[model samples]
Target: MVRVVVVDDEPMVCGFLRTILGSAADVEVVGEAYDGAAGVEAVRRSGPDVVLMDLRMPGMDGLTAIEHINRLPDPPHIVVLTTFDADQYVLRALRAGATGFLVKSTPPEELIGLVRTAARGHTVLSPSAARRLVAASTDSLSARDRAREVVASLTEREIQVLAGLGEGLSNARIAARLHLSEATVKGYVSRTLDKLGCVNRTQAGLIAHDAGIVEP
Candidate 1:
């Protein structure tokens, strides 16, 4: 079963989500919280597979809470399921490590499927929302030029690794494709991240895509 913890400041929203997802045979409402702090506590206690988080909650807020939760030894997948998807908050939430973004207006069945996808470590984004995010990013010529310079620092083999990462391939898959050891692929990925001035693989992929190094 995919255990879930629903968090929102409003009781009605929390109850509504619980009711909607609770009906699924593959889903279980392990706990609920009215604010971010309580949501953190509930997540710890319930050991849920996914967290349905409201981005604008009081007392720590969803973005802050997600950062904390991500620091846990075994953090649950986080889905930013909020009424608001403004540029500022949505971008911040994604940067803080939300597994996906789902507006509260999403259909219940679709929401349930997204929750399941997140539980399995998938990166989910509504198609329109994703386009919006990409368009929202400035990606100025300077930034793209800088990104190209950064990418150019990598060896040809490492460039291949970045392309694989942009396609969401794991270390093992990259290794197989390149006829190299998994450890070698991991090293290439790490070096690419360092060269790209990125904090993680996800950021590197984003930069590569935006710079047209990896193309969409």
Candidate 2:
């Protein structure tokens, strides 16, 4: 089973997530927290495989909680849940080690799929969130330059994989596009992450988009 924790200040939102996630036989809602501080405690106590975190909270906030959670010995993958697609902190949260972003209005089935994706150590970004991230990449010139340098180090095939990631395509789709096996595409993705020194595929995708390996 994929263990998950939902962290949102609103009790209704937490309960909503609990109900939706409960419908999936392979997913288990292990814990829930009403604030970032309590979210940290819940993570420590539950040791969930994934955390669905809200960006705005009463105390400590989601960004602060994400940083703290990432510092844990064995951190769970965190997917930020936000009300807006272009939330100002989305880029910063990704830099702070969030695995991905999901708009709060995402369909329940898609949310469940994303949670499973996070559990499997892959990044999950809603379509609108991906566009927002790519559009915001131009805001940091120095970061883009560094991303370009890192991307330049990738092999030709690896570059193709990174482009697929930037476009938010899954491993199977990437394989089909590049005419490679899924296992081979997965290997390339792993190597690309290592080369870019990224914590997750979402970060790598940001770099690829910023570096012009893929059109925004």
Candidate 3:
């Protein structure tokens, strides 16, 4: 089972998440916290496989908590809860080692699926969040230039893999798309992350989007 913790400032939101996640046979809502500080504490104590975190909270916002949790010996995968208006926070959280972000209005089924995906060590981004990332990239010329320079180091096949990642495709899917084995795709992804100076697939995806190597 995928163990999970729900962290949000609002009690209603926390309860709601717990209910939906609990409904899944393969998912267990292990804990719940009403603020970021408590969220961090809960994560450490419960050792959940995934955390559903709200971006804004009364004390120690989600971004700060994400940084702290990521430094732990065995950190849980964090999935930030956000709204479209909080796109900036979403990006910051991702940079701080969050596995992904989900809009607050996300359908219950998709939200549960994303938690499962994160537990599997895959990055998740809502479609709207992905669009915001593309928009953010469009406005930063320096970032674009740097991304392009980094991407230039990749081979043709690696470039294809990176593009697939930008589109939120998994290694298995990328392999099918490029007619390569899953192992080859995984290697290409790791190499691409190293070349782009990215800590995870999410960052590499952002770079690929910024470099215009993949359609937004």
Candidate 1 segments whose C-alpha is farther than 4 A from its true place: 84-86, 126-128, 138-205, 210-216
Cα lDDT for residue 206, model 3?
76
Off by over 4 Å in 3: 126-128, 137-139
RMSD, every candidate, angstroms:
4.2, 2.2, 2.4
Best by lDDT: 2
Higher-lDDT candidate of 1 and 3: 3
Write the residue-wise lDDT of candidate 1 on 1-216 in tens digits.
999999899999888988999889999999999889999999989899999898787778988898889888878888887666555577567656776678889888787888888888766664345435645766446656766777877888978888776666678988999999999888888788777665445556555555665654
Q: Which residue pairs does candidate 1 place in steric collision?
A: none
Ranking by lDDT: 2, 3, 1
Residue-by-residue lDDT tens digits, candidate 2, 1-216:
999999999999999999999999999999999999999999999999999999899979999999999999989999999887677687778877898888899998788898998999887775456666657655668877888889889999999999998888899999999999999999999999999888788888888777877765
Residue 69's lDDT within candidate 2 is 97
Q: Backbone clashes in each candidate structure, one number apiece? A: 0, 0, 0
lDDT of each: 0.77, 0.88, 0.84
Question: Tens-digit lDDT track for model 3 on 1-216?
Answer: 999999999899998998998899999999999888999999999999999999789888888998888889878888888877347777767766787888889999788888899999888874456657667743568768878988889999889898888888989899999888999889999888888777677777777777888765
**Worst-scoring 10-residue span by lDDT in model 2:** 125-134
